[model samples]
Target: MHDFKSNPQFQKLQGKKVLVTGGAGFIGSNLCEALLDLGVLVVCLDNFATGHKHNIEEFLGNDRFTLIEGDIRNLETCQKACNGVDFVLHEAALGSVPRSINDPITTNEVNISGFLNMLVAARDNGVKRFIYAASSSTYGDSKELPKVEDRIGKPLSPYAITKYVNELYADIFHKTYGLDTIGLRYFNVFGPKQDPNGAYAAVIPLFIKKLMNHESPVINGDGSYSRDFTYIDNVILMNLLCLTTENQQALNQVYNTAVGDRTTLVQLTELIKKYLSGYDPAISKVEIVNGPNRRGDIPHSLASVEKAMEMLGYEATHSIDKGIDKAVKWYVENQHSF
Candidate 1:
């Protein structure tokens, strides 16, 4: 019953100094915006490897906002960003199943080595909290309806393995090094600024972009594969909850940050078409190619939010329908540039 839309942990951030690695990426940028809105001094670190400068361009002149263009793999850069920062939200990673499958070595280097560097830096700086973006892909190959944190299966892809490794290292850091860290297992997060032009684009924005161009969007599988599809606002709430929550029992743990619901790609497609009809009815008629099942694809993924609710006080406001509309509108406004 913990409410996220009007969060109490939010007030705990005012006057705090925060460093958000990968703060230029989609989720990271959204997080940076929220932190700044709370009157917190925000520092963003990114390599531009997969992040866009335009995402954080609006904050360039703000005194409270600082952008550090660097890779997290460099220990020195990590230390520099962590210096004098109160909370560190580490969101930097190569985030694509296909991309990781195509080049796992690069993924491992960034996700594993880079994560370790941040951990070392945060420990050195004595940061108050170390919150990172973990993925629900950690529930790989599990046939469960709703994924629970304590229970997990073998990682299906390199991306999944890398994320699971993050949780492992974080737990070790807490027990071995005495640094308080929390991991948020995000399930299919989508929203504004999610790059739709990339070869490995996420579903919502990529499909919206393709439909806007009057092109057929590929539906990687038979369209039956479902996801929890948490929205950016929900994710932003969870991140804030992790940063400021004082529940001693919740420390040194991971929470599944997602709406406890399911929507298949076909259902999502219909929802998008319905929403875009108001903007441009032509999008409703766009073609969708039903391709074969994708490699490393799971049939369904739903998160059991009982833990986040009981401990972290996470309450997801936007369901898939409402979240998709917001995402489609953002894509419609921005699709012209690319």
Candidate 2:
């Protein structure tokens, strides 16, 4: 296995043509920025179904970047986006448990159908490698303290099932069609560019946005549920590392992309409150509104990144505290939009 950090193979993707599906969303935008910084030619595809255009507006003039406003649910769109692309980073999907619970068909239409569209497109286009956005929700009902790769429980929600299904289809595509693919099962990833004003936004960004606006954030399930919130930079590094590594053993596999540490909702709220106080001591007045248990919500989630460490030489540099500090600062500066 190639050491992800130490190997010279990291530079192999420097000038490659990379396609980032959903390149206008939080994670996809961040990934696109990283790729642009590395001198990679990036073709960003998004339908704006759930992604915002402002996310990629900053890169509009870059000679190395091209933005195609389209959806992956359409196979022709996926094929056109994959044409001449050297590698694929599939991050496009409709995400959120509550949203999925309310509208399972839309989630299925986008997540599963859209994912299949990209996989087939990448395969037919003869892309160098296919890397996709898998979810930690695949751990599902498995009561393991720190989730490992091979073991999983029944999916709790339609969203979870869609993500887990991505992994399954990706595996099948690789084995049956002789393709190379890697799945990064992200665990509550958060950082700059994360959307906070949405009805189904993720917790960290949402809470930070709420606190910045002097609003009391809800503490679902008494704020006891914990998570391993991974930072975007770490995710960017993992993707870059995985895309270039020549380890045959690492292909056709899924790896947990997280810091491998758990923080409870109460503790997370306290941390956010502490950071926000720097802006306005009065902002500290934001209190938790304890609510009924959320449907399809897991009690706790932490990842055992041993597989990533051993096979991909992946190491998380930021702790949950560090990620929160950075994310909170971004939300503070962009409070009005929230």
Distance from true position, residue 163, model 1, in Å? 0.6
Runs with alpha carbons beyond 4 Å of true place in candidate 1:
1-8
TM-scores, all models, native as reference: 0.97, 0.96
Tens digit of per-residue lDDT, candidate 2, span 306-332? 999999888887888888888888887
lDDT (Cα, 0-100) at 194 in candidate 1: 90
Model-by-model lDDT, in order? 0.90, 0.89
Residue 320, candidate 1: Cα error in Å is 0.6
Clashing pairs in 2: none
Instruction: Please report the candidate that would top TM-score against the real structure.
Output: 1
lDDT (tens digit, per residue) of candidate 1 on 89-120:
99999999999999999999999999999999
